[model samples]
Target: MAGHSKWANIQHRKGRQDEKRQRVWTRVSREIMVAARTGGGDPGANPRLRLAIEKAKAANMPLTNVNHAIAKATGTLEGMSYEEVRYEGYGIGGAAIIVDCMTDNKVRTVAEVRHAFLKHGGNMGTEGSVAFQFKHCGQLIFAPGTSEDRVMEVALEAGAEDVITDDDGAIEVLTAFADFESVKKALEAAGLTAEVANVTMRADNSIELTGDDAERMQKLLDVLEDLDDTQDLFHNAAL
Candidate 1:
């Protein structure tokens, strides 16, 4: 795993509220629907659904809304079907970027995604262009000054793969996708709350950006994140 820049994480969290709440709920509901459709509505039997529900809870989505989404996926209610899509690109400072989305209208989604890239000093790439620079894993990151020893002990005992502290003193616990929920529970039970937790494509390396490049990159990310269809976005830039 590559060391993540705290500034990037801070900006992401700080800017999340700028996105419309309805859009966030839509994206998370799509995730739940897909997970339930693929596995089952029972969270105990479906890891993906469990994770989706966890995210819904974190976002403070209404329980009624969550139940309705699951019901739709389980065929108890009507719902708009969606498909997942990924876009790769290079942003300012030559940083690799990946945009993940879910949409019922592929044509509209692609057109908007491409336009956002081009409008923000970025260029879209072929499917595999920048994905090679990332790793698919479950990541739980703690803020700086967290107790490294405690995080490591609880995480490793709960089947985490690694506990790394970056140059900025942030502690990151990496786990296999299968072990993510278990490890997360253990860490929380140990009172080591995470600042960010998700199953994501983590960059394997990073490019440092400064001055105009950094400002442009941040703007590009903000634009992409605000897209209604975008579920998640990742990049290998240290702002």
Candidate 2:
């Protein structure tokens, strides 16, 4: 919460080329499968599944595909079972990176991830290496020109943990994972929608990188993101 909004990363991901956006469907489908598998197939009873569904919708995934993934995860159909794996690493200038993936083959995922790191001026670390630098929570970010007072009133009244307005005028609403759904519902009801909304491992501090260091870090991140099994990536770098 002390550093700037993680919106920078979100924006960078959102700005991926049109060709790269095609891969988003695959990633969100895996997310849907894992969420359903972990918390039943009923979105009404499972907040994670509900969020995954929302992501699927945002990605423009077909409803048929969504239902099929849920069915497969719930055992109505045969499919490769997936397990979540997290990789911690340091990018150029010692920037912390956390990569989350869902894969049936852990060995392949790890090798691909490690190769990306080593080949792009990074070092993969053991579990718990840089995780201590982050907090797993819900984040909702509004644009710089949005109405801050209105957002603060609605968010705080709906159980938000904190509302931060950055020096650059961006509004950030922080919530516990448990309160995320409720807060998001309230904001939407009030006709206030966020530019970025998700449950994420938000960095507690940021590493400012520029010039060669920043360029190398971005290249490393792009490689990891393009991997077929990679689900999500987080970093503390403010490039």
**TM-score of each prediction:** 0.94, 0.95
**Most lDDT-accurate candidate:** 2
Task: Check candidate 2 and list the clashing pairs.
Answer: none
* Candidate 1, 18-91: lDDT as tens digits: 36667777888999998998899999999989889988887789999999999998999998987889999999
Every model's Cα RMSD, please?
A: 1.8, 1.6
Model 1 lDDT-worst window of ten: 1-10
lDDT of 1: 0.88
Candidate 2's C-alpha runs over 4 A off are 1-8
The candidate scoring highest on TM-score is 2
Instruction: State, as a TM-score between 0 and 1, how close model 2 is to the true structure.
Output: 0.95
